[model samples]
Target: MQLFIHQMNEEASNDILTWQYDRPYDFYNNERTDEALQEILDGSYYRMNDENNVLIGFFCIGANAKVPAGNEFGVYNEDLVDMGVGMNPTYVGKGNGFEFCMHVIRFIQEHYPNKAIRLTVATFNERAIHLYEKLGFVSEDKFQTLFAQFQTMIRREHQ
Candidate 1:
């Protein structure tokens, strides 16, 4: 599928703010709030859409970024770009995982080529972990928050 990554705009962000996912995936859904709105407005996030003009998902990259799982895994170094992503509820389980993630990885490779990418995912999210592993991300560390255990995965620039 052809995907385009666009900087978040008011309309897109507003649309994204309303996305709701099911059960386990609900953890990836976002809430609409002033702070969240500000982050979208500040260019910390981007909207991912397909060639058909459907909004597929969103991805965030940077030093001051807090991914989907929050900071439960603790802070990463400035040299590493903490990346996060979530697919629209409607697009969650139709075998688009690998493509969605590869697009995000390429997006980072193009824009922030010098920085390594790091992500934190719930330990129970075997689907995502499997995808990450298949894509060459190494399991670097693990941590636990009050809610769930998370695994920190990284794909260095050389890998």
Candidate 2:
């Protein structure tokens, strides 16, 4: 499958909705509500897809995001663009994740020299941890959630 970057127009809203419904934990929570998505797309975040019109994921270059304990503003400071991606749940476990992300990361890194990409996976998500590490991210530090559960997680950073 091939990938294309599209803006969130009238046509791609459905795919965004599909992603929201599929990954509630990461994409449909309070932080990623309908309005949040609207903002993301409205901000011209790059949406990913293949030749079949399948929505792979999306990422925003130079996205200034708040990373709980980590402030990612000007962190990469050069060509680094902060990116995030999600694949439709139905298409998961089909071995497309690694290839998909690898392509996205390489593309962005080449275009944005010295652009460091970063993502946050839950402490319990080993598959994602391995994928990020395999893609070259390093474990920076362990951070504790300030919420009532007081759970902790290791923050991975890559450049």
Candidate 3:
């Protein structure tokens, strides 16, 4: 699937806020609130669409992608390009993760060349963790928040 990343917009952001995932994955769900919409439009977030123009997911970089608690743990010490991603619930478990992630990685590389990429994920989400690992993201650090434990993974830029 071809992915096109664009500046976050209200319609796509609203649609993303309505996506519902099952059980544990529901932790990533967002409410259609003013604050939520504001967050997505905060400049750091980008909307991802497929070749067919369907919203496939979204990506957020920089400080917005880092869990606040990670600061206390010193997990964000490195100046890596941090990223947070969310796939549309409908596409979740459809074996599209690898391709989707590669597209995101390439996007980041183009925009931020020579920087290592970092991602923090809930430890419970083994599937995503596995996909990241397969993409050359190695386990870097682990930190716990009041609600969940997260593992930070990193993929160094190619020389």
Candidate 4:
């Protein structure tokens, strides 16, 4: 599970656009466009790769993404770093989620050690919620947005 995390470059972003996932998961897919590359270059996204240098996935940290009911769900807080992640569709549902998340966690720790982490997920994303719990995140609140219900989870220092 050797992994590396780096700021996404144009080449990496272009490659990522080719990755796909199943229904629902695919809804969060990246786009193949210049705007996508610009977003990556802006530093809101990261490119992840394995020891062999194969692109594995990508994750977002401290992006301040505005989810539905962020305030109501208590998912957004100044004290905690917000994280969002996705694995290459080719690598998902094959028992690699935990490892992928661990890499993202380690990357975050390297840059923001001691900072608590928070994430918001669709209520229907049971798989992601399970993995987050496995990684020491606990749901703190839940709320409904205009489009869907969301749950806010947090991984505090004590955890």
* The best candidate in terms of lDDT: 3
The 10 consecutive residues of candidate 3 with the worst lDDT sum are 150-159
Tens digit per residue, CA lDDT, model 3, 1-159: 788999999999899999999998998878999998898899999988999999999999899999999999999999999999999988999998888888889989999999999999999999999999999999999999998999999999762
What are the RMSD figures for all models against the true structure?
A: 2.3, 4.9, 1.1, 2.1
Question: Cα miss at 14, model 1 (Å)?
Answer: 1.7
Q: Report lDDT (CA) for all predictions.
A: 0.81, 0.56, 0.92, 0.80
Model 4 TM-score on a 0 to 1 scale = 0.87
Model 4 CA deviation exceeding 4 Å by range: 64-74
Q: For candidate 1, write residues 13-110 as lDDT tens digits.
A: 88888998778867766789998788877877888889998899888887435444445445453457778887887877788988999999998889
Per-residue error at 123 for model 1, in Å?
1.1
Q: Where does the lowest 10-residue lDDT sum fall in candidate 4?
A: 64-73
What lDDT is reached at residue 95 by model 3? Answer: 95
The TM-scores, one per candidate, come to 0.88, 0.68, 0.96, 0.87
Question: Tens digit of lDDT per residue, candidate 2, span 58-132?
Answer: 655444232445442222333335566666665665777788788767767677665456554555556666777
Per-residue lDDT tens digits of candidate 4, residues 1-159? Answer: 788888888787788777777888776676777776676677888888999998888888775444645875455656788888878888888999998898888878888889888888888889899999999999977888776788878888777
Q: How much is 86 displaced in model 4, in angstroms?
A: 1.1
Q: How accurate is candidate 2 locally (lDDT)?
A: 0.56
Rank order (by lDDT, best first): 3, 1, 4, 2
Best by TM-score: 3
Candidate 1: give the clashing pairs.
none
Candidate 2: misplaced stretches above 4 Å?
Answer: 18-34, 64-69, 72-80, 146-159
